[model samples]
Target: MPSFWSQKSKCLYFYFSGMMTKHKKCFIVGAALIIITNIFTVCVVKLTQDSQSFCPYGWIGFQNKCYYFSKEEGDWNSSKYNCSTQHADLTIIDNTEEMNFLRRYKCSSDHWIGLKMAKNRTGQWVDGAIFTKSFGMRGSEGCAYLSDDGAATARCYTERKWICRKKIH
Candidate 1:
């Protein structure tokens, strides 16, 4: 029969081996959890950064463009000149949504825009797009203004608040 001391030594060795195995499993599981959590946090941060890209301060962002509405009044030509100085142009209404946005956000009832009358008595936008004839522009005045009713032509010298538009960088 084995001596008592030898049997005791075997028991201690087996106990220590089992404990070490359990400890090693626990350590590996904990490490894996930490790595997974870090990866998830990184992914969330990247997604939020992409989604939060926005326009500059004091400008409204819409469809990848920025719009600025002036509080001070200026004539159509003066307003266009002012916008050109800032590397922008008077606001051009391309659709009903843009028209509605301007009407809603305009500082006053009359706001100068980029629309004008061409030599042929036809309406044209500053960007050289021909205005659709369906809008029923009545006056021979060269400049256009946004009013409560809709866009209407006015004399180019008439002073009014203006809207400017530029592309987002």
Candidate 2:
């Protein structure tokens, strides 16, 4: 026959083992829930950030910038004035991607861009971008336009459609 102390020791060992198993299961479940919740939170935050970066209607969004192509034609000065009224400026092409975007969306007619002569008569953009001469800038008058073959210069008084651009807040 087993001694009373020996039976009590076996009962205590089995009781502790069963309790440990239950505790382990609860810990694993709690950890999994926490991980899942964190993943869901991260996904939601990314979605909201993407949506916030979107531009308003009628404006095209690209890399934190918004572009607007006008349907009306005007002189370069008048086009610039129009853009100012909209709290923007003539489109400034900073890279080939931006240039391509403008080219792809521009109307069949030429569109006035931001390039022009500075007060000192050197090439400059209204937004103060460095003029790198990516296009064949012709004419003594220095007002630039987005032509089918690339960028070209014409007199500021020439009538053309215009592009506007602004940074997305």
Candidate 3:
């Protein structure tokens, strides 16, 4: 009887050992997957940071925010209204890159910008919580257009797509 019990114990030990060996492969695979996922996450973060650092179109990309030049014909009131409706504001050039991008499409004739005369007429800007500072200003051009030049304010009504800038989640 003692011999029979010893034999059963040995068999149990051997079975457990074999099962552990098979589980070793599973453990190794799981560890490898963890390492691979960590590496992939790091790479994705780095790539996103790089893209944000330098805007592809010379526009300033700041803290998940992007601005574009809008060249559409609209009155100051309408332009502000439009931007507000879209949950954005008129183009604001926060840095040199943004300024350069906007200048590239400047018109020979002054174009309307997000800025407007303050109600007091004291040269102060009147804003409806859209923008704190005027992004840019135009001279006597009641209408706006998206152009580097060669287009008049009257042509702004030609129904061209405009630039819209917003923040990324």
Candidate 4:
């Protein structure tokens, strides 16, 4: 009877030990996976912060975009051509923030934007987007420029300081 009890105790001990070993292995694997996931997440965040939104020299950085306020004035077509040479285009105000920013920063001088008169006499952006007419325009000409109060139109041959924009990414 004593031997039988001893054998039964040994059997129970072995069973518990095996269960503990399996649990330990599972815990180790889970920990390893968590560490790996954390490392990968950190790497992705660092890359995003360091590499995703770089701007060129002399361009002002703004929320995933870069804007260049030209020092020299040019006609609408010539200004567009100048921006293309710099691998950018005349600024396209896609939102109120951009519009307000340009309005505030232009500083007492009219700046030519991408807007121009289309064949149908509607204001169109250089990328072919129809102007939403978010604000009133004041000119009676073919090319539009951003002015102190809002946008105004002038002849395409009229020279004005301009804004250029390019995506950061």
Question: TM-score: which is higher, 2 or 3?
Answer: 2
For lDDT, the strongest prediction is: 4
Number of the candidate with higher lDDT, 1 or 4: 4
Worst 10 residues of 3 by lDDT: 1-10
Q: Which candidate achieves the best TM-score against the true structure?
A: 4
* Candidate 3, residue 107: how far the Cα is off, in Å: 5.6
For model 2, where is the 10-residue window of minimal lDDT?
Answer: 1-10
User: Across residues 86-129, which tens digit of lDDT does each residue of candidate 1 receive?
Assistant: 77899888778888887888845688888898657788888998
lDDT of 2 by residue, 73-141 (tens): 999999999999988999988888888878888857799999896545478899787788665655567
Could you tell me every candidate's TM-score relative to the true structure?
0.65, 0.65, 0.44, 0.68
In order, the Cα lDDT scores of the candidates are 0.77, 0.80, 0.47, 0.82
Q: Which stretches of candidate 3 lie over 4 Å from their true place?
A: 1-24, 41-65, 93-100, 107-110, 118-121, 125-169
Per-residue CA lDDT of candidate 4, range 13-114, in tens?
A: 223423422222445556888999999999999998877578888888887888999899999999999999988999988888888988988889999999
As for TM-score, the candidate ahead, 3 or 4, is 4
Regions of model 2 farther than 4 Å from truth? 1-52, 118-121
Select the stronger candidate by TM-score from 1 and 3: 1
- Report the Cα lDDT for candidate 1: 0.77
